[model samples]
Target chain A: MERMDLEALNNELLDAVLEKGSLSFVVNRLHQALNKGVLICDCLGRILIGSNSEIEYDIDAYIAKAIDHSEAYYYDQEICQLFFPIGWGKLIAIIIVREVKEEEIENILPVLETANLSLCFYFSKYNAIREVENKYKDLFIQDLLFNNILENEEILAKSKLWGWDFKKEYFVAVIEPDNFINIKTFAEELEYITKKLAKENDIEIITSVRSGTFIVISREKNNQKERVKEMIVEKISRANKYFSEKYDTTFSIGVGHTYLAYKEIYKSYQEAKTALAIARLIGETKFVKYFGTLGIFKLLYKQEAYLLKEYYYETLHKLIEFDKNNNGELLPTLDALISNNMDIKLTAEALFIHVNTLRYRIRKIEEILRIDLSKLENVVNLFVALKIKALLKLHYSDID
Target chain B: MGYGFLFNIDACIGCQACAAACAKKNDFFLGFRRVQKYELKYRGKNVVFYYSNSCNHCENPECLRRCPERLYFKRRDGIVIHKMGECRACLTCLKACPYQAPKFNHQIGKVSKCNLCVDETGDPLQPKCVKACPTFALQLVHEDYYQPMAQYYHLPIDTIGKSHITQPSIKIIIPPELQKNGEN
Candidate 1:
C-alpha cells in the first residue's frame, strides 16, 4: 500500500515539472512530498529555486567536494542536511534537504532518487525541444537581419510559428553577457528568468540566442513612441536589476527605435547593434541604450573618417600624445572624470587610485592642455573630443 | 607617440623669427617654416592671428607612402625625413601630400622638403623655429598627444584646408580671442 503511494507521488512531481517548466515547482513538490524544507541550486551552489530556509552548511564547498568525486550520483548525510547530486550527462542541480535527522535520510533516499530521475528526464526532453525551436528561430532571425528576402506577409507568417505577432510594430534589443564564470549555465538561467519576467510584465517578446548574444524582440501596437519606450525600458530595467542583484551578472542592452512595418524592424535591429557598439566604446555597458537619444553620437558616427580624425585631434589629441610619450594615465583619468560627472572622489575610486593621485593627474592634464578643467567650456571640449576619439577608433581601426 | 610641432596661432605675432631661425639653421632658400597671417571678422571686429605651418610628419605620411622612389621615411619619433640621395624627382609624394609638403628643389632637380633638422646621428633636433618664437608660440611635441582641435566658438576649422586629408602631426591651439564667440 505504501509502495503505491510513492509511485503516485513520483507521478505527481513529474506532472508538475512538465506543467510548470520550473525547477522551483519540482522543488516545492519535493518539499511537500517529504514534508521537509527543500531547495535547488546550480553548479556554483547558488539557489536557483528554493524556499526561505537557512542552509546549515557551506553548500559551495560541499558542491566542490562532490564535483571532485566525479560520480553521477552523490548522497551523503551531513548532520541535518542531505545533499543529492543529481546528474544525467550534466550536473543539472544539487538538491538539499533540510531539517531532517540523519536516521530519516535512509528512508528519504529512495524518494530523492526517484525525483532525480524525473528531473534528468525532464531536462533532456526540454533541451531537445529547445534545440528544434532554436533551429527555426535562428533561421527567422537571420532572414530578418541578413536575407531581407521575406516580405511583410512572409515575416508575419513565420513569426506565428513561435506564437509571436510580427504584424504589430516592434523594437529590437541585443544583449551581450560579460564577466561570466560559465557561459552555458548563465545563458540558460538568463533565458528562463527573462521569459518569466516577460510573462509577468505582459509584454510580448520573442527571444533567441545567436553567437552567444541574446536578441529580444518586443511587439507593441501603441502609436506613442515615448509610451512604448517607457514600457520597454521598465521591463528591461526590471530584468537587469533582477540578474545583477541575484547573480552579479553584468550585461549591456542596446535598444533600437520603434518601427511600424515589419520590414523596418530589421532597421531597428541594425540600429540596436550600432548602439551596442557605441555603448562598448563609451564604457557605458551597464544600461539600456536607445538609438534616437544617443544625441550627437548618432550624427557623429556616420561622418567621414578624416573628419572624425580631425575633430579628435582638435580636442583630446594633446592629452593622448602626452600619455603615449610619457606613459601617462591622464587620458583615462580625464575619461573617468567626465564619465562620472566630474566627481573627483568617484573617479579616483573607479581608477583604483588615491584621490591625491587623481588630483595630480588632473592638474597635469590642465597644465599640458592649457585648459581649465573647472570651466564648463573646456570640459565640453574635452568631452566632445573623447567622443570623437572613440568614433575615430571605430572608423579607423587600422590607423594605429 | 611620434614627434610633431605645436603652434599657438594666437601667440604668434606674424614674426618671421621662426623662418629666420630656420634659414640660419638649415641653409634653405625660403626657410622651411612658412608663417602666414589671417584676419577673421568676429563680433563685428577683425581679429588677426598668425598661422605658422610646416611638415606635419603626418600619421599617414602621404609623402612616404606614395613615393615611387621611396625618398621619404618617417622617423620612429614621428619626423618625416627625405633621403635626397635616393631622389628620382618623381614628385608622386609632392602631389599625394595634402599639405604641399614635398617641395620640388629646382637646384637639385629632385623633390626635397624640411627634414626636421637632423643631427649627426640622424635624430631630429626639435628645429630652431620652435626655439625662436618670441611669444612662446611654436613648440615641439609628440605627434599623437599634441593634436589640438580647431573647434571653438569661432570654429576656425574652415580656414585650415585640405589638412583633413593627410592627418598631419601638427597641433594648433586656437587663441582664446577666437575660441570665445560671446566676447564684446
Candidate 2:
C-alpha cells in the first residue's frame, strides 16, 4: 500500500481527540482506512479497528488456537506484541509484503506522532482518575472498618439519601462464577450488567473487588427487601438467559438475609458467599438463589451447623490419633480411610494393610466411642460428620 | 548507577521548558507533560514548585509489583526501566503509584515514564529534566555523594519510606527565597 496520507491522518486523529473526546475512535478509523490487510486491536485485546482480507476477526477463535499451539506461535504475528507492549509503546504489525522505503516511514511520521499523542493523553487521564478513585475507596473501606464511627446510626442516617433508620434493611447478593470460567471476563460482565440494572432502578451501584461481586440493595422499608430481591433475581435470570443464548454458560447468584446497617454488611457478604457455594454444589445452568438452597447439611449433621463440624473433627482427629499411636502407618491409613469410604477391609487393601489390623483399628474406634462400626448407617453418618467437622473448623479460620 | 531525577520547587519559574524539551527529545505526544511543574501553596505561601518528576526508580517500586505484564526493570545503578514490548497497558501499576509517575498513551494501552534518557541518543548522563531546566533546578548528580546532598536539602526526597525509598542519583535544588537569608 502507498504510504498513508500522513497530514490527513494527523488532522483526523487531532480532531477526534478534541471533538469526539476519544482516541480509539480516530485510531480505529485510521486503521480502517489503511486497507493493508492489517488487523488492528486495542489494548484490551478487543479488535478496535482492522483492514479486511480473507481472514475474519475472531478473538475467541484466536485465543483457542493459541491454547492449542502451546504459547509458541507468539512470534509468528506482529499483533502478538499486543499481549505485552512495554510502557506506552505501540506494536506495529508488518506483513512481509514489501520492503517499504525509508521515505514512506518518514511520510507517516506525522500521523504516527499524532496517534501516539492521542493514545498518551487517554492513558494518562485514565490512570490518574483510576488512581484517585482506588485511593479513595481504600481510604473509605479502611475507615469504615477501623474507625467504628459508622456504628453511630444517627450520623450514618443523616448521610443517607433517605435518613438513616435502623428499621432500614439491605439485602446482600454475592455473585460467583464457576471454576471453569475466566474470572476477569465474568467479573467485568457482571459489573457491567449490575451497573445497567442499577441505572434502570436509578441507584448508583457501589462495587469493589473484595473476593467476588458483593451487591447491597438498600431498602428503607422492611417489606421492600423481598421485592428488591425478586427484582434482582429477575434481572439475573434475564442476564443468564442472554448469556446462555450468546455464550452457552450458566450463572449462579446467592442472596443473604436483610441487615440493618453497613456494620453488618460483612456478615451478609459471608452468608451470600456460603449460599453461592451451596448453589455450586447444586449446579445447573441457570441462576439459583442460595439463601435456603441446601437441605443436605441439615439432614447429614443431625444438629444444625454441627454436621460440618463433626465431619472434620472425626476424620482429622482420627488421622492425628492414628498417626500418634502408630507413627509410620498414619498417612497410608488416613489415605485409605478417605478413599475407601471408611470400610475396614477396603481401607486395609488401599493401605496395603492386613484386614485384621484394619478391624483392630475399627475395634479401637468403637472402644473410643462405644459405637458399632458394622452398621451402614454408622459409616454413612461418620463420613458426613467428619466433613461437617472440618467445615466448621474452617468457617472461623478462613480469611479472605 | 541507574537513572536519576531532580525537582527544585524554588528555582522553577514554571515556564514548562523542561516539559517541552522532554516532548521534543522523545518525540512524545504534545501536551503530555512527563516533567510537570505543579504550582501549589505550602503553608499559605505561594510556592512556585516544579516536579521535574517522572519515574523515581524507587527501591520498593509499586509500579513493579502491581504491573500485570511485569515489564519493569530496576538496573543495579537504580534506573527503573520498562520493556514496552511486554506492556499490555492495563494501568494497574499506574493506579497503584502514590506519586503519579507513569504516563499513559491512550491511542495504545502502553505507559511511559522518564528513563533519564539512558537509552535515548542524547548525553546519557543528562535527562530531559536537567537539559531543559534553564534555572539549573534539576540535575542528574552522581550517586556516591548526591543522594546525601538531596536529603539534607529537603528537595522532595524520593528515597523515603512508603513513597519512593530508592535513592535516585540526582539532586534538585530550589533557589533560596528572594527575601530569605539564603538568597543569592
Which candidate gets the maximum TM-score versus the true structure?
A: 1
Candidate 2 residue lDDT tens string, B53-132: 56666533556545655466555456666777667888887776545667787766788776667876654476665777
Separate clash counts for every candidate: 6, 37
Highest-scoring model, lDDT: 1
| Model 1 steric clash pairs | A314-B148, A314-B149, A317-B145, A318-B145, A321-B145, B3-B77
Model 1 regions more than 4 Å off? A1-79, A93-96, A147-149, A179-183, A220-249, A303-307, A316-337, A340-378, A391-400, B1-184
Question: Candidate 2 i-RMS (Å)?
Answer: 22.5
Residue-level lDDT of model 2, residues A89-136, one tens digit each, is 343211111122334443333344545555555556655776787556
Which lDDT tens digits does candidate 1 get at residues B1-184?
Answer: 3678777776888889988887777666546677777776765678887777767776445565456553455554556778787788878877666566667777778777777777535455767788788998989876444432323213433324434324467766766666554432
Reference interface contacts recovered per candidate: 0.00, 0.00
RMSD of candidate 1 to true structure, Å: 19.2
